[model samples]
Target: MPLAIVHQSYGRFGGAERVALAHFEQLRRMNIDATLFWSGLVTPGWQTRLKGYDIRTIPSTLPTPRNLATMIRFLRELSRYDSIIIHHHVDPLLALYLARNLGERTIWYSGSMFELAWEKWITGEDYRSISQTVKQTGQEYYGKTLSSLVLSNNVFDQTVRLARTVDIHAVRRYSKIVANSKFLSRFLKRIYKLNDTPPVVYPGPDPMLEQLSSKDFTGEGDYMLAVSPLIPLKNVDGMIQAASKVPSARLVVVGEGQDRVSLEERAGMLQVPLFLKGNCHSEEELAMLYSQCMFHIHLSLYEPFGLTPVEAGLFKKASIVTDHGGPPEIIVDGETGFIVNPRDYGMIAKRMKELLSSPELRHEMGQKARKRVLEKFTLERSAKQLLAEVES
Candidate 1:
């Protein structure tokens, strides 16, 4: 029997999609019958790119309205596969419904605690809208009054607190729960109060990095690179303040987000030479920027696992990452890359100046960074670990 993998659509071409694609490639390579079930608008290029893969489009937007109806349709459609694997922070109630109908042996994959809490925190407004739509549709497919009733603030609070209970429900219904990192596994255990250890499968590097590293560095190496979505948590404003102290070094920020205009204004206020190059989707362009920069900077408040530092390392460029979250695990302090306090812009600028003045030191750190990634954090390693866990 073939494996059916259901996940949110590959939206905006971000980190999670990259992980899903890597899994898809690996399954194909292993000659496993794997299918992708997703819901969203897929671009033509992406569809063309995934031509060989078996893909089913669910007729609903993400955080789909009439979630119960969507789940009913999904469960009915998913009955064909012998095994089902769900990724990230999808509604587990749907999995419960599928399990009740299809027997209790489906697989469930979880990425982070951050995602489980996202709808409660950042996505509340969107969830409300989705719930309102579902309410109006008068759907009661998930043993509920309506989908809106399920997403109430009181219900959301109860849901978050009852995370452990839900996991127990999933454990009883599903075959396995696959987690992305050890950090996340610990978080799950604490949150769910579970004795069972979830499998730790790290995410892979960007495929673009492989092609990018094949070419030589071609840009003028005078600026520092900070490549991330311009969001509040990314600490782009802090990067600008740090760059201001090093007047000679330009700060080139790649990727766009809601905070771009505000960040640009902040940069102007600081009188920093901050260039916002919105969305460098092209790997060659990103590589050129990485190869030519003095170093890469990532001061995210929290990151599950940062890929940019590894990319910078591949290009023999030093990186400065925040002390918090997964970046500390990714970067080796004073070896591969520097780690700074997210709040301390002065120290960050000082470190930047120190690296800028010392070319030999930068080269050495860059080499160390590349070696670290090659040794520990590769797609092959990630795929093998995940496959091993699934098989086990």
Candidate 2:
């Protein structure tokens, strides 16, 4: 099949971008002709990463007023493919338009709905407030007034509401909707009021990480590594608070965001040794960090699918993840790693202490983690499943 993968942008080469690229690459290797369509910024660092791919950028009114020009351009280009797979709905207006126009050929591989997760994250409101409001009040009450509200501000909440105002059925237009994790599948069904749960195809670790694992790497260090954007939703403050309780436990963070300065300040105030290595664009660097760290920690709030833990697992390292969202689904509690409540710093710290105190336990859990990744989470497996779903 001629396949086209549509992703919002490569603003940061984060987990979603990595998964999208992996799917495109894997499908090509399987002899299915594929092209990737991305809109918006592709950083120079990300450009290097996407060197050999068949990637094309499209014009978008991402923040500006909705335009028919953008839709016409997208329709002309996307109509060529036999099938289309959309990664996320960050640009819901565009996404809804494409899905409506090409419903039968499109498969939405959702990480999370925009308003359900990100709007809450961006606005820092109570989790699922909008979803619950819509559920109780109905779309009639919530969506009717969205146009004027969206025009007033470029807030994500209003944008999604405005798009749904045209038609509340975003995922309904697609031929199929698949999720990245089981937790996310449930979330989609609950929020979208779908009768059946969406099928899940877990994203894999970077294929490069598997190759790098064979290299000679140093022993595990006293520090725990976090490969997350330095953002409020990632709960870096929670990580810092947890680190403060555990003596001699250094926290090293990769990936950059607006919260860098505040995270640094909090760490300083608490006298915790924190290293913020802004955006390790290289997979080798990331893999090495995973190989050397005693264990990995990802305490992100409402993370759709925690790819960091899967990456860490590839290097035979266990992770301390949150029970909030998909990370718990990635981790086998008390086996591969402990899944604690993201809010409970004491519980998070206790798990960290247990890992630090016992090299033997860490080694055992790391072994199990690697085994789990090899058995269940891999690029080959994910790509095969993706191809099967699209073809079916």
Candidate 3:
């Protein structure tokens, strides 16, 4: 049976997409007949990346009411594959269709449950309920033979008002569950009310990191780093707020999004020496920047699975992440790096001062962080685990 690695969007190589794409490449390398199945338009840079890969695009259709047209096309195309590994979804209408139709023969490769659950609670009622393309019972996809429900994190606490336990229950009833971290799996089991413990699979550093030599990349001076798609959840503003308090701290943000203007304005108002390098041209450049930094600071209010921390770990740069989410899972508190409260920029600055003042502590934490990543999280390890689950 041929394999289909599916996702909502393909352009720009986001964190979740990177996980699926890495698996895609690995599967092909192992001689598995895998296809990159997606419905959206592939952006310019991604087209070059997928040049030799087996890609099959769905019919370009309207996407106003939750990609109903694409779902129709997806439904038409589902029967051909023996297994459908859902990497991500833009619409739960597809999940509803799959549970009622495909059932146990599916693998829900969850990047995050927040997107679907939150969307359904907000604007996806019309699409999940009564779309013009296909009408069915307003039930989420669940079945007896479900291969697995892979979840990145449990964002239930933040989205409680909008979503429900019943809604979470309907979605979590898979044959097996896969979580990206132990911290997340604990949240997953509690929130979804599951009996069985899910396996934790940490995503590795970007494949580009392996190509860069350590000698070629090294830190120049005392400057903190943050790599995030300039967004509110990433807390670029929070970083700026904290940076304004620490005069010796120099923050360099790598990545861009809609939140850039607002973050820039706030930084200007505070007179923080914040440099936003929109997007790294290549992973080599990104790795070099990581190497040059004293450490990486990631403060996400609602991060599911963070690959940037792992990348920072790979770069041998200690990652100072927010205590609340996946960063705690990756960073061994006060050992690999420090984990501070997401809402406390004062504490963030304090942690920054703790590391910035001591070069010995920074080196020790950086070494430990890199060792942890090398021992546990790697593309080879992740691909092997995924293949076992999919091929079993």
The best candidate by TM-score is 2
RMSD of 2: 5.7
lDDT of 3 by residue, 251-362 (tens): 9998776677888889899998888888776656777888889999998776667888888888777888987667787889999998888779889889888888888988
Of candidate 3, the 10-residue stretch with the lowest lDDT total is 130-139
CA shift at 14, candidate 1, in angstroms? Answer: 1.3
lDDT digits (tens) for residues 1-392 of candidate 1: 47777765323445565567667766777777888876543445456668867788654422446765776777787887877777654444554565577645477666654333343443343333322123332233233454455557668666554644554565556677777766666656765567788877777675557667768676547888998877666789899888888868788998776677888998899888888998665557777888888889999766666768877877877899998667777788888878999879999989999898888888889888888877887777877776676667
- Model 3: which residue pairs collide? 104-145, 104-146
Residue 176, candidate 1: Cα error in Å is: 2.5
> What TM-score does prediction 2 earn?
0.87
TM-score of each: 0.80, 0.87, 0.80
Model 3, position 65: C-alpha lDDT score: 50
RMSD of each: 5.2, 5.7, 8.1
Q: lDDT per model, in order?
A: 0.70, 0.78, 0.68
Clashing pairs for predicted structure model 1, backbone only: none
> Which structure is stronger by lDDT: 1 or 3?
1
